[model samples]
Target: MTHVSGKRLSVALAVAAVLATACTGGGAAPKDAAGGYSAQPKQTGTPKDGGTATVALTPGLSPNYIYPYPPAAANGTVVARGLLWRSLYRPSGEGDQIADAELSLAEPPAYSPDRKTVTIKMKDYKWSNGSPVTADDVVFSMALLKAALAESPANWSFYTPGQFPDGVTAEAAVPDTLTLRLETAYNPSYLLSMLTLLYVMPSAEWNIARTGGPHLDYKQPKHAKAIYKYLTKESESQSTFASNPLWKVVNGPYLLKSFDSTTGSFSLTPNPAYSGPGESRLDQVDFKAFTSAAAVLNQFKAGNLTVGTLDSSFVSQIAALKAKGYNVYGAPAPARLDSLVINFKNTVNNFDKIITQRYARQALQRLIDQQGYITSRGVYNGAGSPNYSTAGHGSPYPPAFGDRPPYPYDPAAAEKLLTDNGWKVTPNGSTTCERPGTGPGQCGAGIPRGQTISFTLASANAPAFVGARDVAFASAAKKLGIEVKIVTKSLNYMYANYGNTYAPATKNEWAMQDYGPLYLAAGYPSSNTVLNTEGSFNLGSYQNAAIDKLINASTFGSDGKSLSAEVSSLAEDLPVLFLPTPHTLVVWKNTLSGPQSSFNALISFLYTPELWYFHDASGARP
Candidate 1:
């Protein structure tokens, strides 16, 4: 799963800006530049090879686990992991095109005619420990993942039962070649897309057999549990980051040199034995942690940090940063969307009865002023328009959002829909079901007469923008006779309390949730883990039999039409009220240069840091 940062401040400032304009009925405000930022800073001479670059991390947030298997891994961990390890493919290109996967550790895979077998040719790379990376390491890594999945199937939602490693057999016919023969034919491209997230670990150091047996027996639940516990515990401790013998082996650009657990800060030195492409031009890289977005800006302003991400909350400050000679680049909004997920199974306060109605959901969608919320939240200038589909605007399948025009901000339409559904509107816009029945103009089954349209919306307390949006949304809902109560909590708390696997009793507490820009891996853009009935990320436990069939078809279907049709259906269903995709702003010292592409939207500015380097004061590479 892609990491989501919960460090943005409230959008009070944005809301104030919008209120001020509306109160005065002022003309359009001056528009900032709309295009995205460049991938690298301007350079005059050859690239320098030895300067240290300091990057900024979110305040109060640090890498909790260096390993990638756990869903709780933070953005800092994702960025750092890229430096320590190499996947089979990496994100390439820019803007929406950045989702393209480029070969990294191996050549393009060769598939058999039936597409059941895929043969991958390994690159002649060596780990930092001087051991040659071979086919056996890849097979062993898969075995470890399988064992980990056995303990927690949700860890790898892409793994189908009796597929891939279960029915498939991996054979290292030669030191460089690994062949995977599957029992059933699968989409070769989709399989490769899934591999983009599979980090190939050196088996000699990660194997469970080193502790007891020759290899982990994934069939044994105890062995799987033991391996997961040991690996997770080892990776969670900051002390093990630099000292753990298991972590010393690597094949990427850098190795952890030091870590400060107290400050959530760490430094990496170039790996001398690294055999991957784009060698580290800088001798050392330091990740500095801040306490807030303001602190991060202050550090960048004071010339203390070389690379940093400018939060959207500080869009107004971009001009000032550029005036001070910082190179500001706007990354394409990640292929993620922040949404309001309505829990269909919520038994709390009989909200499920109201939420289960298609008219109610449709009315709520129309009641949302997406553009107003974007402007009031200070995200309009940097984000794309409101999305209607589950997949982002940049997803591979172009969604033909069925014949309906984008849900307009029409409170009248919302009111009409509620009234037609037997909701009695009050002068203040509060509503109650007047004619509860089992027919038209009546509330659905289980809904009683006089049931008020009310529910609590839980949103992240940080990233103040979301809070502002929630306020705006609540205000609008008031006009539609809907009572919306807003509750703000930390992102961690929100996920733990209302996440996909949360207990039904606990998950039903909140009627709706506003979080995310939930990122999906590059090339694998299907919403199986989000909208499917058994989706691991289905926080709302929404189940539609038709949707379930479509999701399954999209996942296994080889043709693009089937996937497009699924996206279209999701758009029509509106499982979650879609929000705009915000642009990711990357701010850096004018002297540093590097590849700025990112596969995940949440951490778009921190991608491919190994290629980042510094030039001398004369605008020339030293």
Candidate 2:
């Protein structure tokens, strides 16, 4: 983890950058201006690099894959991206996680230059099959992420399709490079994020035409969106992407050699012929897995933790590690934010899902107390501030920071909003909806005057979520006039089929749900992925055009636009709110220093393993 530097220049620069984000619509960062570091990285680092750096992280598994292609926190994907894959473009250490941020891909043509198109040249690289990595691969991947069902069938950040308000079309404009044509001015980093954000299927591995395989053209409108589904869903699962020549079609420094599916452990070694910037410095990287985080510290003490994330409880141990002359690092978190996400597109009968009411759900923003929550958890280095509402809009940009007004805490206002909307609060505060006095047929006078709503909730087995957030909200709702019953189950079952009835998936069990999206980055629950009404990441399905428009405008301005001024001001009103910023302290030997690089900020909890180098990190570069 990067240590908190009090250098006035760096702090001033940091303030100016985040202030640019806060005032992006033109607001200023917090009063201190120098305290712009985000309190917690909601996500972890996937920043590009190699070497084994064991650390403690929470929710360390993916949906089920070796790559972040499907995005499971605990899965092999995060690790895989770090050592094996590359994004079209990379972020400049701003924003938190995959949604709503800048990019590292080929920059768009400068408008002043009057250039309508930008051509990206690929390095002289090839798939593991030895096929040259070309513009088509990028085009293919971009098209896949853009297709309408990108989220449902393919990659995790599905709403990116709409990101191109004017839209962009990629083609093999050049033999060795791709030519991207955007209708309006766009950020290269945003588009590059797709290539950087997702695990790219090898044209060779997927048996693509360019790989001496199939002649399939994903460019066809009909086949574009489904291309993502093909590589991810159609192919058989691999035991090791490195060992299998078929799956080894990548361009990174390391390759997978062995894996243990049952234990989720895997190993990697240098790829003799990788085409990226770094050279392998270690003999090999061994990834060990455990079901509980508590065991991570003990393992690290025994020299088993290749990388480490400090849990609040292990703060003393971390100090001990530092005192013992080990490399102890407190890296500055990159792209991370934690959120209590809800999927509103959920089925009416989907009891496993939570949050059906729009205003009621938005009301959650005010009800949460972030400071109190973070205090309760207690595992941070105290360098970052609460993103509170959105990430990067303040401390990340410039000018001593710019942001919206504060989101106030008002339980009474929250209850009143629910009450004025035909809800009747029982003495105990369990609310029941009064039949609509007038409006749609079902909610109109046609229905009974008032009715009570009672249901059970289904939750994934994540301790922080199920044990803390969900339970607390359930109790709080009782005060607002609703009965919420809690049910717990394995994370796999809860994530994929919680919305389905218990009789079939779980069989004969019925319940409502109140679970959040597993955020590796500490993110706000109001971006395209989490809140866009038509966007894929809007899992909770809570739709409000006003909020959506505000979010859209905010994200556009925040990403690389001049619109920060407006968005920062709007966010002050509040969108989605978590009472506390979740944190996990990381302790390493004092031998660590410089930038804690990694695949990206998705692994911020571990403080970016790739960047971990001895304090005298000068000669270690490849």
Candidate 3:
């Protein structure tokens, strides 16, 4: 589920600078079937007995919160949540599948004939504490997740009003099995996608509200809330993450070893008691945080970094990198989209009214140079593909978004739109409304005469391309008299504080935001909590009854075309100004040997270090 505040990608997978790479590789470098960067680089070495692998945390993103279900404002990088606990269903890095059946904590869910009841059978897994990962743990997780949402929808991005986990009731019928009865039936695929986010914790060990406190029944709502508060409070102390006993008890392959408070770097050691399928071959995985992409590139050049992403701006350095014994591979991240997130609730300068106008949004979207950004050496640098809809490239759910964009880059068309809407377009000045009435060809309701097409665009400071593209957009908008005030914020700060749903104080502070990418769940990329009217992650409060209906049809109805209808409608409606799907250039040392799936996980904002190990070029343990 893509978050508004940057998560894994950028905010919900928080931000990836919309990148593009026309060049797959120079020579000897591997390539995917599409002739793009290979998801699975060929391995020359045999599996090592045990070795350490250093992974790079995305620039400007650090794991600040340890608790899996932290508030949107408290959520940090996906690395934090993923490394600490295992979700019920692990996301299959393959673009075609929702979950990796073998890696998941539970077997594929079996739905009743009515589709309201789902029975899940747990795998033979155990927490580091040696307790079986039980049905009670699943129920406990659901209870705590519900409690978090009860506090505020801002607590969870995937939540929609009165939806899954809201009206759903769960019970552990047996030690290794659980059943969920939903008040409303959902598409089996959509429900499965939702379950992918349910990370299971050690219920028996974490049921206490205080350190050394007596264990309490977590099924009770009040007790769950108390335990949640206590756990969240404990997560606030960054320095104690490695030392905290509560954090050490894990169900995943790795356990927290040490955490650097200043740099946000952390080390993990294999969980000796991990009962999952993976070898947990790596002795230790070190995640290093950096201040910028340039720094990361420097480390790559110096051979100091093993696994990290290369910003598109550094695409020219690919050959240089490959020559340095590194494998450079990249492709558009699956089920992801980059967009200029507009805030529909912001009434400042009548932006809410102005932006609600279809033509106004079309005009603004037209000002974006998607192709220019992709081709510009300063921007995406031929590393991304143009995207115009919520359902990203190569989506299985066919998009009604035509081959040609509904609103392509055309300054003249943009100018005509403003002028036709009764705005006085000044080529080098502010375009102001001349007609105020809410009638045909007049400025919409509450937009008084003299209203200007101007708004603050909050751009993420990292991933250099984000700012470059934003500046280009602003420059284009300026030609049509749209005044775009550019303000830069850190990627982490944007993910933690930019959205109006979570940060009420910032409601009027920003009109548009570009933090990076919003990653939908793999395989089934539904726009339930993203574009829905009451969506928890609907950061801009974009409301359209028709869109809401379409979203509902896709989410609740079983019609195969429902999602396509939703995606097409969103494409035409311009819910957010969709940008290109940037290719994330994943760079790693050639010595690392693992299944292609492990490297592919990076594209989905998931990390599987337990499956990765360091090996020598000659197929020997390093």
Candidate 4:
């Protein structure tokens, strides 16, 4: 589902829009018969034979410091990768687009009956520079990814723990075809999903290993490990993203042609020699970045861009747009659940002692009144469904999350949790559990008894984050006798140097923070990218033997009824404190179309722009 941020529109999907009563901005589109958006499609007359779609861009609205680390790129990502980087055997509307459904490799990857060692035959496939994307690309990608991890082991640890073969740099397997030998039996599905991040850089072109040049010269056969660490430091800092030729390699359907750092704007075109079936519809997209919510809305009004909603409190303004027939269409956003995690890492910050308690996390969850945030706040505005599952509250895959009851949104239960834990209520409504909860008087001797436990919270503060998040949390926490100080920062600021704040010694400043899972795809009950300490997205650093085992089972185990139940059991215990994961609105010039069908709740909006062609000046949907 797509969304207009300001006013929540129930975007009903349709082909063409009818005539409008007037010409203006700030309104909602009249809902059509099928319950989709019906509007007079913005007319871009004199449509050329296809030049460039500048994509009035917002380059960094996602606020990520990195360019493409499974990080969200505004129009840039969709334009560049979607057009430039075409994966081998990638997903499509009907079937696998890159490779035939019949797994026809030379010998169909020599599998060791146990399915651990996959000997892939890279007879077909070529990179932008015309080099065959061999097993070496795969091996190189895995090795570089491993080296990429070694750069900052903690940050990249979640995806592949112990992925690096010890001193096997010479044997890291850069060759014509990849013969991946796993220590344990890995599921076929896990190997396929790994493709989401498996960007095979041309061995000679992608230099994550060599020192200078746009991308670190990863082609340097020897220093494969050292260069990855250096390149990652550059990647995280958005260092030289524009200058890197390695970054421009074609893997998907698009490639980055030009990017402007100041405007946060960029343009991309279809690769000429690219071996792919799909070609981009709009050759150019003018992307215009906006700093504040006001700037985003203002651009929409001026007709510089096409789509938008009242993400800010301009609820009334959104109504006005409908009156004038702006054909405003919107969806809340893709369904996601926002959550909070008490960083288990060592820290002297406030709440370090309190957060360690599992019950303490549960207690905080109960106090937060997640229901109110879901219902009253209208955070999703209207397009989204409130969620309670990692797989989502309701239907999708195999229904991993049974239709169980939502978490207890009871404040009273929260209070009992605090009181029963020996937290005494002071004159000022706040409660304080004795240090260590039950320690010698010395545990209480050093720290103040009634100083009111100070809790620090940090969040991305993205558009959806601004007002909806911290406010409700602050209000809920205070009622339960906790003094929480909210720290709102930019997305770029938070994912500094490495995906974490500066460091525990110099930068980490929160007891709990708004957490966005570094997870790439959405799945049933299991997740390595979710639970693996080696993944870039597993931000919370949560660890439990039972939880880890179940997640592994979910990832590698068969997708079955029993596996589904395990995920539900984990959620009940609040693996991470559940909060409302709100929807993200994609606002474009009304001229933009053909994106919704490509939405894969698992991947970003970068999937199918090749099929994303536009209508003639006649403004036809087809």
Say which prediction, candidate 1 or candidate 3, comes out ahead on TM-score.
Answer: 3
**lDDT per residue as tens, model 4, 1-622:** 1111111110000101221111111112222222233232343434333533333233234222322332221111222432444433342221112122221112234557876666666546556666655665555565665554454443332344544232223223545556666666554544443443344555556554445545544545346666555544555434355567656665545566565655445555665555554456567544455666666666656655543434523333454544433344433222234467556553543454556565667777776654455445334343333445554322122223333333556777766666666566442366765543255322232334554556667766665644465677777777766777887776555554112321444224656666343222322223454544433345445566776666666455543333344446556666667665443333443334443434321122333445445545555431
Q: Which of candidates 1 and 2 reaches a greater lDDT?
A: 1
- Give the lowest summed-lDDT range of ten residues in model 1: 6-15
Q: What is the TM-score of each candidate against the true structure?
A: 0.87, 0.70, 0.92, 0.73
For 1-622, candidate 2 gives per-residue lDDT tens digits of 1111100000011123433334322222222111222232222322324345443434445213543354222222344553555455433343433322222223322222333466666557655555666677777666655553434321343343455422667768675766667665443333333333433445435534222545566777556544445554422365544454544666555677776666656676767776544445454666666665567766766765645554443444644654454443333233233445443443333322224444555555656544444334332323223544344332332212333335445778877765666667674654656745554322223224555544455665654433565666566667666666678766555544432211124322434344433332222223444445555444344466776665565444334432233234325433344433333334444433334334234334322233343332443412
In model 4, state the lDDT of residue 12: 7
Model 3, C-alpha of 417: deviation from truth (Å): 1.9
Worst 10 residues of 3 by lDDT: 19-28
Q: Which of candidates 2 and 3 reaches a greater TM-score?
A: 3
lDDT computed for candidate 2: 0.44
lDDT of each: 0.64, 0.44, 0.79, 0.45
Strongest candidate by TM-score = 3
Q: Which of the predicted structures, 1 or 2, would earn the higher TM-score when compared with the native?
A: 1
Q: By lDDT, is 1 or 4 better?
A: 1
Output the number of the lDDT-best candidate. 3
State each candidate's clash count.
9, 131, 28, 77
lDDT of 1 by residue, 304-332 (tens): 88777776677777778877767776534
